[model samples]
Target: MAKGGIKFKDSAAAYERLAADVAARRFAPVYLLMGEESYFIDALCDRLAATILDESQRAFGQITVYGRDTEAGQVINLCRQMPMSGDRQVVIVKEAQQMRGLDKLSLYTQQPSPTTVLVLCHKEKSADKRSAFYKGAAAHGAVLESVRPRDYEIAGWLAEHLRRQGLAADGKALSMLTDHLGTDLSKIANELRKLLVSLPEGTKRITDADIEANIGISKDFNNFELCKAVLARDMERSLRIAAHFARNPKDNPLLLTVMALFGQFRQLFLLNYLRWQSRHKGLPFPPDGELMRILRLNNPYALGELKQAAGEWPNRKVFAILGLLREYDAKSKGLNAGGMSDGELLRELLLKIFLL
Candidate 1:
């Protein structure tokens, strides 16, 4: 699967590499942090902002300016100033993309301050590649461009994040968090921090229980159960779960719910397609090993429910369900949707799912 951020081998590798540099006290002359993934960009910038210069030196040696508040000229002048407290100084530019005439940074990069570590944090999107500022940052120092991790990639990221905090998570817990949090690393990291702090001391492994208790995600009524409920063709059970989600809209958003269903249906479609191929070719059914790889399943039992669902639902029906999911997903985002509430939309969608 596709992993790392843009230009890196794995999604987390870019962040880890830069973090290691920060930990090693290896400061670059100019750092350009650009990414759709704000988490790593912010994390890396925060580490540099907090470290690099000591508290005493920060009074005169550090300056943080926002792109909306400051221009390239002002930042350049600040960066060129000599440190008053010590030999090293730090100049951090947050939301750098919002800075007017940001390409003017190329002028400063040509003659960067010897005693300063200048960091430009471009959040939400990357800076223009053809711009001189990007080129100059590359010529002068380091640039970290992070792409958003996919849902599958987030599991590995969450594991590493927990490992650094002296914690681990179970397979089920991993699925719950990834589905709930999706690809937003900052949100996931924030929730995890809150979760970790609230846990009793000496807790080493995170389980579905920990998530349910601390994070308030009901392991019994979450999207996993919703998927299971639908697979079993239990309309009553499915509606009950939908009611639970409606009660806790803060925890179970409609978009996330729609996304979870899409993922489940996609997996079912693949399984049904495989089965169809086996039948047509007069070959033996594909084994669990191949199914595990195709489904990206971590455990054997995860397949049991999916296998059952695939058998019950034909490939054509599953394909149509995927289309229906996309339509509802758009409606959830207010595309061609009237004043229908999320609950209304979801209730209608579930009824249609059963009809299909």
Candidate 2:
């Protein structure tokens, strides 16, 4: 468990520790949940709400209040109240970031009631580190910073989430979800839940077909497949995928496609530079772990393809393709593109990438 000023590699790790503590019925005097990601914070709050008190105990002990309706001084007074019929009282302040005089809570936090569990749900923002309230909470209780996962980390997190549900997904299916859904954890979890429910009781595995059937993500013509085709330099497949995307412009926006291509080519350029440095400058090629970290690639399977593509596309070609991708990205955004439809722009971009 980390103390103050913590940076988790992913949200799941932070959730795991909190879940374990809550499950064990071990809690601190105060919990300050603050960060950009609300999914984990919301999950922890939900779990705490449901688990900390039973139906009978909740009626007497659990008090849920909103920050806008209550003051920091009122919260302290409530915390001072004794549990009617339980050992401890749980006072949850939702959206505590909006509470006026939040800093004044430091007065009570400094000598908090050992019999009260104060949960402050400060979503999407951090408390002032120098404030008395923040320092007091850090010294007396736990401070969980719920940061969102980066784009690359989503696939691995989704895979692990599926495994916990007794469901399995392949790399392609995982990539399809990641690419289509992006980094919105709440939406991804909801969709996966729907997919899980759609499966028959005995069904254990989720495939690209399952995703397509359940979530409307195409198995063959999606952005994941398009990127794979481009990385392999398969002119025929790349053009075909681009044409499919052109036909379904709503699903495959030209800007997103161009951005994906730009990222792939950028990775290749970096890999080329690193390889050059290793060859002539006596620097060793980074180990697999280091390479993945440097490349910001969470999918090892995709990393393999990227490494192969780097070898196939020379540094000079990668540079040129990057420039072309940048131009197309701007054009797709309607910067200087005169009247080109998304389809025509996509087709033109594919031609340039294939030729390069």
- Index of the highest-lDDT prediction: 2
Q: TM-score for every candidate vs. truth?
A: 0.89, 0.88
For each candidate, the alpha-carbon lDDT, in order, equals 0.84, 0.85
The best candidate in terms of TM-score: 1
- Residue 293 alpha-carbon offset, candidate 2, angstroms: 4.4
lDDT by residue (1-356, candidate 2, tens digit) is 22354554545787878889999988889988888778888888888888888878998899999999999999999999988877999999999999999999999877889989999999877788899999999899887888777666787788787787777887888878888887789899889888888877898888899999999989998888998988887889988988888788888888777766777778888889999999999899998889888887766887898887787899889889888888988999898888999989888888887777
Candidate 1: residue 112 Cα off by (Å)? 2.6
Q: Local error of candidate 1 at 301, Å?
A: 3.7
Off by over 4 Å in 1: 1-11, 278-293, 297-300, 335-339
Candidate 2 has a TM-score of: 0.88
Instruction: Give the alpha carbon lDDT tens digit for every residue of 235-337 in model 1.
Output: 9999999988877788788998898899888889888877878889886777899888788666577788888667788878888899999999999999977
Error of 1 at 132 (Å): 2.3
Candidate 1, position 188, lDDT: 90
